[model samples]
Target: MEKLKVDGVSVSFGDNEVLRDVSLTLMPGELVSILGVSGVGKTTLFNVISGLIRPSAGRVLLDGQDVTGSPGRISYMLQKDMLLPYRTIEDNCALPLLIRGESKRTAREAVREKLPEFGLQGVGRKWPAQLSGGMRQRAALLRTYLFSKDVALLDEPFSALDTLTKSSMHRWYLDIMDKIKLSTLFITHDMDEAILLSDRICLLTGRPGTISREIVITEPRPRDGDFALTEEFLEYKRLVKEELGA
Candidate 1:
């Protein structure tokens, strides 16, 4: 089933065009990544799909319903973790539920039950300051998931972490995704990270960014550490590099 679709989406800032006729779709439970160079308007495409910015043209569809220019229909996680410093991690994760009129106790209890899954056991009551960057991201993702479980639009959610931590989080994220089964659309400049996490990758290229290539990573899910060093991985790197003119 097609969970989400962006058909011929275009966005512009006055006379400056950001994205032009970019289109992509997410099948139910599939994880797709957008790979692009800086200033290619990947975020603008994301903003259009998430309905934060109305597209200059085209349609945004969720489950066959036309939802263009609508917000609150999909979950969007920006580059930052954006967890409230004053709130406990549990409270932070529960904020989405709370905002939807859930009782504080119920929200916290719901969040508490999933703390271990968040890799946050014994840390839920702790402040955001007490946790590592990876943990903060996990919490933020949990909060995003709470907002909309159907689809998640993630923008470089792991870019801040060091290589080692990011690697671990990639594994954790894939595992969590299997259990939750949410369709995901993410944008990342890291070729390896994109190849590692995505089932397929859509390349956004040019001044008015368009999805120029959609590369399917035929490798099985939850790839091992050595997958990046394999011939298939190298081929993906080669193809992506060619697409980017890098």
Candidate 2:
């Protein structure tokens, strides 16, 4: 069964329509990228899917069950880390489990067991300010996964990082996702990042967002820096750029 099905979704703020007849599906263990310019309602779509906002129209189904307007089933990681300055790294990563009523000891244990996998071991006791930007983002991602949500909604999660850090984190994220077998909806404006990390790309038009085109990346899994330099990858980026009128 499909992991997620977004059917004829529409949203508007007051009289200004944002999304129009937007529909898509994500298969189990697949990573899908949604690419569009700023103000094209990409972030708004994330909000709707993550239950941060109600869609003006349409339904969202998760694992074939209707979860429209339900909060907490889908995990969302935003552009900013949103980490609490007072909380330790381990505590921050444990926030999701804590909210789910897990005991502190249990939550810390779970986070510690997975921290090394995410390159965050040995720094759990440090404050967010003590970690580098990439480390902080990794912790945020760990927190999102700790919630045990089947679907992850990433909204420009690496946009704030420098190019080098963003590239490194991209590889790390792909490895982590592979290990966890997550079904993801990643939103971004970077064509290279989208093509490098996604199983399929959904290109959206500006303003009232709609899927202008969809391209499947037929490359093998665990895409890395080498894949970014391939001719096929460059062609896909070109096609998406043309579709977006860039």
Candidate 3:
């Protein structure tokens, strides 16, 4: 069964239409990337999917149930780390579970057990301000994933990092996602990043967004820097750029 479905969805902010009849399906364990240029409503679509905003029309289904206006089934990560500067890393990561009424001890235990897997083992006691940009992002991702949401909506989560760091984090994200097997919708303006991480790339047209093309990445998993240099990868990037008028 599809993990998440956006059916005939349309969204508007007053008279400014953002999404028009946008539809897509995310199967379980799939990593789908929505690639579009700036101002193309990619983040708006993420917001709609995560229930931060209600669509002007249509339904959002999660595990075959309509969650169009439902709350909290999806976890969202943004470009900014958005970590609470004053809270310890572990505390910040555990906030989601605490909000769900889990006891503090239970939440801490869960975060402690998962910290090493997220590469945050010994730094849980440190504040976000003390961590590097990449570490902050890792903590943010851990916080998002710790919620155990069925779907993760990531909006340009690594765009702020240096090219080298961004590339490394891409690999880390894929590794963690593979371990968790969660469905994900990632939005990015970078064609290379989209191609590198997506199981399928959904290219959106300019302005009011709609899927213009869907390209499947049939390559094997655990793709690395070498994969980026392949003829097929370059061809896909070229085609997507041409389609987007990049």
Candidate 4:
């Protein structure tokens, strides 16, 4: 069964029509990328999916049930890690469980048990400011996972890190996703990042953004680090560029 579905969604803010008939689906354990240039309604689409913004038209469904305009149904992470500097890493990650009615101690314990799985072991008691950029992202992702293990809406979550850190986080994220099998839909402007991390890429284009193309990456998951340097990867990139030019 499809894990999540965006069915013919459209959004408009007064005179500005930001999106039109945008639709996509995520299967279990699938990583899908929304690829578009800036101001192309990528974030707006995510907002609709995350139920923060009810689409002017269309339905958002999770596991076949309509869940449009309902917040807290899917986990969402923005470009920044958004970890609290004052809170301990453990507490930061435990926020989700706590919000859902778990006691503080239980939340901390649960977060600790899952820390090593996320490449975070001994940093639970440390401040967010004390960790490197990559580690902070790990913490943020852990928090996101704790919030909702079913699906995640990531908006350029790794875009803020330096090149090396971003690359490292990419590998880690793929490995973690392999273990957890969380259905993921993310937005990114970086072509390379989209190709490197996605199972399929949805091209959002037009004055009022719509899914102009859906390019499947058949190369397989946990793709080789050097895959980006290959002809097949270049072909996919070329196709994306061609579609964008249309």
Q: Where does candidate 2 stray beyond 4 Å?
A: none
lDDT of 3: 0.89
lDDT of 1 by residue, 1-246 (tens): 699988998888999998988889999888999999998998888788878899989999999999898987887887689999999999999998998999999999999988898788999999999999999999999998888876889999999999999999898988888898878998999999999999999999998888899999999987877898899999999999998999
Residue 7 lDDT in model 3? 92
Q: Count the backbone clashes (under 3 Å) in each candidate.
A: 0, 0, 0, 0
Which candidate wins on TM-score?
4
What's the CA RMSD for each of the models?
A: 1.0, 1.1, 1.0, 1.0
Clashes by residue pair, model 2: none
Query: What is the RMSD, in Å, between candidate 2 and the native fold over all Cα?
Result: 1.1
lDDT of 1: 0.91
Task: List, residue by residue over 1-246, the lDDT tens digit for candidate 2.
Answer: 999998888999999999998999999889999999988989888888877778989999988888888888888898899999999999998999888899999999999998898899899999999999999999999888888556788999999999999999999889888888878899999999999999999987867899888999999888779998889988988888889999
Candidate 4 lDDT, tens digit per residue, 137-222? 88999999999886888999999899988888888888889998877898999999999999999999998999999999998888
State each model's CA lDDT, in order: 0.91, 0.90, 0.89, 0.91
Please state the error at residue 17 of candidate 3 in Å: 1.5
CA displacement after TM-score superposition, residue 222 of candidate 2 (Å):
1.5
